[model samples]
Each structure stands twice: as structure tokens, then as C-alpha cells.
Target chain A: MKPAHRKIEAPRVTVDIVIFTIEEAKLKTLLIKRKFDPFKNIWALPGGFVRSKEDIYAAALRELSEESGISGVYLEQLYTFGSPKRDPRGRVITIAYFALASRQKLRIRSASDAKDAGLFSVDDLPRLAFDHKEILEKALERLGNKIQYTNVLWSLLPEYFTLGDIQRVYEIIWGKKADKRNFRKKLLSLGLLKPIGKLRKGLRRRPARLYQFKTKKYVELKRFF
Target chain B: MKPAHRKIEAPRVTVDIVIFTIEEAKLKTLLIKRKFDPFKNIWALPGGFVRSKEDIYAAALRELSEESGISGVYLEQLYTFGSPKRDPRGRVITIAYFALASRQKLRIRSASDAKDAGLFSVDDLPRLAFDHKEILEKALERLGNKIQYTNVLWSLLPEYFTLGDIQRVYEIIWGKKADKRNFRKKLLSLGLLKPIGKLRKGLRRRPARLYQFKTKKYVELKRFF
Candidate 1:
């Protein structure tokens, strides 16, 4: 017979989100200034501890809303960071999530445990708290790779966008300039975008033809792309 | 000033491993028969609770060793499962991991909390305990997708293997027959395999040349592949 199993202590679990969006033709992420000690007042990913009765996903959504004042946007679990020394407050393991959304949709404000919150370009991030710098780098890498094979880049665009608008989102996330004609050709070949039969308004230059992402086509072609 | 945060209860965390190996040209996974309630006698992935002082990765390795009697193999964190109703023992969340190794190296036995342990082909798995079925399916899908872009499948092969042996591993994981010439052409064109300049000694037919995976080349060519 097996000996009685000993009760094990659980690690304190927290959820951190690296929320990405495209603003001013550049990729930006939301960050919150910590209000408490152990890197207090430094910028970090918006997150908090998981509540006893909440599921992990629910906890992530709650924390995202409380810290950034944004909700209902879908997030993907990027990774779990649990280095023994990652947290000074003793054995806290964090489940990291990444979300992509349109910059105009989020009305972020400092709330709950945060002192301040704002969007910063990925290229011009401040010195982050905890292992948040590492987390953001990993999230960016995931985003770059995901945009190539998935329709996830649509999350960073508005309801109706021109082909140039979509290409700029890709270029910003990928950190490189893409050939405009080739970029449109590749995306159009996938058949995941539908022309809106209208032009994007308010552009200084001639209005470009607008397109909307076809959710059904994107779902069908997800596996192949 | 922000209000002081209330102390929150942490969810009970565990680590579950989907140990995979290629045996008899079939992809097999190691499953342990649960000896305790919740899912008594049900075959499940080898796993256990995380200790207070152990890192998450270390906890995964320790649990894998205790239940399967196998150690030292590298494991990748697959995903975390934390549905509120996943475990009847109240708010238990599990970090799932997947490992690839050769069958001969593993000396698996039913140890620790497991009643019995054995290998089951991926296609013929028994109804697993605690959302393990979903975990295994995800791992298999990851393996299929990874084989195309990463050199991860090399973990399933012996150090010195023939081209045919490598092809068999791919066919087993992908569940499809690949054209021998095209497969060899693609893999060889990558320059990630080095020929040993020796032929199989025991074969009755013409001996095939042996080759070893070139880790350095795989690393350099990782981004493109």
C-alpha cells in the first residue's frame, strides 16, 4: 500500500496581460505603474492575483478590466513564468496572456492597484517591473509569428480598413517594411478579407478601397494558414 | 491613495505530463492508473501537486519522475487547465507538459500515487481523467504542427538513425504516408542532417546510410523553417 500523500503548499497565482494595439502606425502595449513596493511605481503589465472562487481565465479578464478599464476583448495565454526568484513576495507564479485590440476602442485609466496607466510604443518601452520586460518580449515574438499564419492581426484593425492600413499593422508588428503590392497580394490570396465597396474616409491622399475581415473564411482557413 | 488590497486565496496547483515515445512505429503516450478517488482506477497522465519551494518546471520534472519512474528528459509546458469543475478536490489547476523521448531509455513503473502504468497509442487512448483527453489531443496537434517548422521531432529518434527511420517517425506523428523521395529531398535540402558514412550491418537487404541530426545547423536555420 502507498504511504499517505503529504499536503503540498500551492504557489500564489497571478495573471498578467500584455495588451497590444496599433497606434500612430506603430505597435503599442498598455502598461500600468505599480503602486506598491518591490518595484513600486515602475511600469508593468496589468495583472493581479487569482481569486479563490474564480477560474483562471475569468481571473485574467477581471484583472485586465480592473487595471486597464478594458473588457470583452479575447486574450490568449502566452506562457507561465515561475522562476524561483521572479517574485520577491515569495513563490508567485504568473500566467501571462496577450491580447490584440484597436487602439481607439480602449479607454484606459489608472484604477484599482495601479497608480497610472498608458500606452507606449513597443520600441520605446520604459524600464519595466518584475520580469515584465521578458514577458513583453515573448508576447511580441508570439504576435509577430502569429500574424504570419493566423488572422489574429485583424484584432488590431478597425471594422473597415484599407489594404494599406492592414499592411501597416503587419509591418509594425513585424518591425520591417513590407512590399506594398506583395503584402496585399498574399493577404488577398487567402480569401479571408472582403471588400466593403467603399473607401476609407479622411485620408490626406486619395481614399483607398476599404475591406473587412471575413470571420467565416478566417475560421475555415485557420488550420491551413 | 489606492486602498490596501485584501489577501486572496490561491488555487491549488498541480503538474501533469503527457509523456510520449515512438514504439513499434506508433506514437504512444505513458498513462498512469489513478489509485485514489476523483477518478479512481482511471488511466491518466502522470502528475502530482507542486511543492512550496519548487519552481514550476522543477515541479513538473519531479512529478514525472515520481509517477513514471523516468527522469532527466526535457519537457515543454503545453498549457494550463483550470476550469472550475475540472477537479472535484476543489479549485485545482494543472499546468500540463509534453515530452518526447525514445521508448528504450525509459524504465517506467507504477510508482508513488499511481496504481499501474503503461503506454497507449494516441489513437486508442482510454477515457482519461480530469480533462486529460483534451490535453493529449492538444499535445498531439502541437507535435504535428511543430514537426513541420521545428527540429523537435528529433527527440523521438535515436542518435544514429537511417533516413527511413526518420521518415517513420514523421509518418507516425502526422498520421499520413509521405513520399520517400520528396521527404528525403526536403529534409536533406535543409542541411540539418549529417551522414555517418556507414551502413546498417544487420540488414538482409541493401544497407541504408545512417545520419545524425545536426543541432548547430538546426539552430542556425530555425527562423526560416
Candidate 2:
């Protein structure tokens, strides 16, 4: 009937990333020492303010590159944190992005915008600033649940990987041992992996057969997720 | 290292909702008339900027209550949207939430905040604003997948209801007619509903038996979805 009222609230929003990678048979996430006042001197996820010209995902990738110096990783939108009191100065909303990368890619060139940048084990993570620990937990839960149905685990594996490697990735992410037979059977049924007729080194027991991810299937079967 | 350069940028964040309920044998959502510069006069999900003092969930609930006048409904945090160009103005990230309610609870009190709040069928929803159309699609997909294992649909039923009522709720929400015979059998097998020895009213053919949700069992049972 009349002019609608506008909130006129310029809430500060930022993008935080939980960039995960498996290294030395353990799960690690990219962390940065805060150089700002809100959580100064504390360890936190790699993040930054969203630019007016960029979108949320772009902000996440930009923050990831600025804080961790890595790009084009398998990133997924995880959750948003808008707790009113999460930030002491004002209302700061943060969108979290979860990423998976192989151990080799963990050697990122720090963004130079943070006091320090490094990877930390999920199990022994330091106290993170502003509900990030909870955000990380939600991300892990999402990953645990999603890893069963999607081919996301491949993002944490090398270009060519064995079925055993894939199983191990699941085990580490889920923190539970899956039935090897069932896991292998389910993966094989997906029809997205082609046997490369090769074997990888560094196995105590028998080296398992290697397979390559079918990129074409990913495009055609976008519904797999 | 360089005292973390202060980025002169505005972080973008927004909120999306999957406000659904069962009404007239169909599941529906509350859509609003958007009369703004971006998506002028387009029918879109009612949402707003996240307030500084509230958490994302609280912000979602706040937006839901402000726009739909439906509060205290069981709301769940769904996911976050962060596509680079999802918002034309800037890089706006949106946190999505899904709310479930019975058909009777929705009360449209603010006609100015929302131009005629009414239930629209999920399948035949109006054109939405921003990436809200896609957000709603994802929410519906999540709901369909989740209804398979969780008793979340109970939130859409009355305190006491018939097996037929519950099955119909599932059918409407899933958009597929479920096998009535098997659906009833599976629900009963879950052992989460207790027959109250009461009969439903206003049945033309037969007065089906009424049952109360066994909340204790519902909590004890581990639902995969």
C-alpha cells in the first residue's frame, strides 16, 4: 500500500575458506594468523572481505589465493555465519568455503596479507577466531556425508590413484573404516573411473591398480551430486 | 607480514530461504513480490541483509518472521550461495535456510512488507529473484532426499494425524505419488508412531486411525538423512 521500509544495514560480510588437503596420511586445513584487531594474534581460516565487483565464490577464491596462494582447487560452498555478536566491533557475516586438494598442492605460497600461513591438522587444531571452529566442524560433517555419494574424494587424490588410495581418503575423512568390497563396488558402479592399467609406488603390500577420473562423465553427469 | 593490509572492499552476503508447509494436500512455499531496482516486481523468496547482532540462523528466522509472519517454526540451515555473479550489484553471498511448518500455522500479517503472502506449489513456483530459484531447487532436492530416512516430514503434520495424512504429505513434498501400501508399511515398521486409538474426523469413506508421534523413539533412532 505504501513505500516499503529499508533496513539500511551495511553489514560487513567476509569469505572464509577451510581449504582441506591430505598430507602424510592426515587431514589438514589452511590457517592464517590474524593480523587484524577483531581476532589479532589468533589462528583463523584463510579469508577476506568480499569485493563489490566480485561474488561470494570469487571472494572465497580470492581470499584463498591471497592467504594460501593456491587456486583452481575443488572448492564447495559450505555455510554462512551471521551471528550478531560474532564480531565485537560490528555485525560481520562470513561465508565459508570448503576445498579439497592433494598433499602435493599443500605447498602454497602464502598470500603475504596474513601474519603467517600454514596448514593445521583438524584433530589438533588451535582455537580459531569467531565461530570458525564450528564452521570447520560443519564443513567436515558435510564432507563426511557427501563423500559417500559424490566423487569429491578425487579432489584430494592425485591425478592417477588406486582404489586403495580412494578408500584411504574416505577413511581419513570419515574417521571410519568402510567395507573395502562395498566401497570398491559402489565406485566401480559409478562408471566415472577408467582403469589406467598402471600401478603406483610406495606400498607395503600389493600395489593396487590405478584409475583415472573421467572428466567427460563429470560434465554429463552433473546430477551425480 | 605487512600488518595485514586493510582491504578497501565490501564483503557481499545475502540470505535465501526454503519456507515450505503442507496446505490443501500440497506442499508450498511463501513467495513475495520483489519491487526493487535489481529484480523489480519479480516474485522472489523473501529475504534481506544479515543483521550484525544475530547469527545466520537467527538472521534467517528474523527474515522469515519479518516477511512471512511465521515464527517459531522449525528451521534448518541448508547451505550457502557464493557464485561470483549471483548478485548484480556486487559479490553478495547468500546463506540459505529451510523451514518446515504445518499448513495451519502460517499467518500473513504484513501485507506491506510482502505484497500478498500466500502458499505456492513447489513444482509450479513463480519466477524468483537473484539465484533464489536455484536455491529453492536445491532445498527441494535436499528435502526429497532427506525424507527418505528422516522423520522431518512430521513437522508438516498435525500433532495427531492418520497414516494416510502422513503418506500424502510425503507424496506432495516428493512430487511423486508413493505406493500407498508400501509407504504405510515402511512408516509403521519404523516404530516411531503410536496408535492413539482415536479416529480422524470428516472422512467420507472410512475414518482412519490416528497416531501420535513417538518423539522419544524419534530421537533415539539414528536417521541417516
How high a TM-score does candidate 1 get? Answer: 0.93
Misplaced by over 4 Å in model 1 are: A1-6, A216-225, B1-6, B69-72, B216-225
Q: What is the lDDT of every predicted structure here?
A: 0.81, 0.75
lDDT of 2 at B40: 75
Name the candidate that leads on lDDT: 1
Give me the iRMSD of candidate 2, please.
7.5
Off by over 4 Å in 2: A1-7, A201-205, A216-225, B1-16, B34-41, B81-93, B216-225
lDDT of 1: 0.81
> What tens digits encode model 2's per-residue C-alpha lDDT throughout B108-220?
55445455556788868777778888889888887877676577777787789898888788777666787888878877988889999989878588889999888822232
> Residue A107 of model 1: what lDDT?
78
Position A168, candidate 2: lDDT: 84
RMSD of each: 3.5, 4.3
User: Per-residue lDDT tens digits of candidate 1, residues B46-136?
Assistant: 8888877788899888877776666656578999888877887677788999887777667788877788999999989898998999999
